[model samples]
Target: MNLKLIKGMRIVAATHNPGKVPEIAALLGEDYEILTAGQLNLPEPDETETTFTGNAMLKARHAAEQSGEVALADDSGMSVAVLDGAPGIFSARWAGPGKDFAVAMKKVEDRLEEIGATDRAAWFTSALAVAWPGGPCVVVEGVVHGRLTFPPRGDRGFGYDPIFIPEGGALTFGEMEPAAKEAISHRTRAFAKLRAALID
Candidate 1:
């Protein structure tokens, strides 16, 4: 079966994170109907996986099973080199749940300082998985390399956007507009790859 997304396809996304919905919708375009876990009233699955790919696949599989439709899932976060790739999958819980991104950001900054990381080298990674109930599954990934900033900037995106200054750009991801951010975001990169893999 062809894996490419066809127009008017009902795509179930395994996430309640509202911030991600718009981006995903934009990529999938108007031809696809995007449904989130919140809309389905599905219980949030525990991210017990150690890697982003594993977590993404887990969510996608679970959602596809529940909805009996093609489901997409993304697991993404910041990976600090100095931190030994820590806050990788735990980036969300770093704030102690409740989805408090602000707390998480502060914690990241504090940890960076504690480690005396002057370079602040870090990368935001996004792993995407798509699964169809009783069908094969696919996975792809993307990353944007950049350095962390002490004080946050702008207010366009969510999570680690404020501090993530993409390489070669002065402004942080949070400083850029939604459309602009998506153009170079890790998710976009991964989706582009996935699209090519399917369509080409």
Candidate 2:
């Protein structure tokens, strides 16, 4: 868990999502060299775990073992109150094999309407894990309370951003600029905790 010595070492951001790369890099700052799994051409491991922490650790360990370097990974998703967290862990699966967020958004709206539920309460949860080659792993989680919006919103973020409006925020995550969203995002919150742990 002592990551201070790794300040200048190369670390792998164990994810294939391009959108997540910059966000993670921003949080990691310039202290370390960041590389994505895709950049390293590392094969993705199956996310068969049932929880965010489990999946995040799984990915981080996989990347670390493969690259023989410290690796960081995150598992994040939207959980709808009305749906009883239906897509909590399966958020990506909800989009099917093609990863079509558009269809996934529609399904959310349809489910909401079908249930006749007015409460659109939801939250985004992110679990971040860091693993060192043949070493122990650390995991932390953060959540952003919010509500789901019908018809979706802007074209900014990937996944469910178009339909998620944060608490006390007028604009949806999709409508906000990257920096704006990053300021209060679930990932940001998780990264903050992870960063603190590392710095400590």
- Candidate 2 on 86-124: residue-level lDDT in tens? 789999889999999998999899999998999999999
Per-model clash counts, in order, read 1, 0
Model 1 misplaced regions, further than 4 Å: none
TM-score of model 2 vs. true structure: 0.93
The residue pairs found clashing in candidate 1 are 8-31
Give the alpha-carbon lDDT of every model.
Answer: 0.86, 0.90
Q: What overall lDDT, based on C-alpha atoms, would model 1 receive against the true structure?
A: 0.86
Q: Per-residue CA lDDT of candidate 1, range 146-176, in tens?
A: 9888688888888878988999989899999
Alpha-carbon error at 70 in model 2, in Å? 0.5
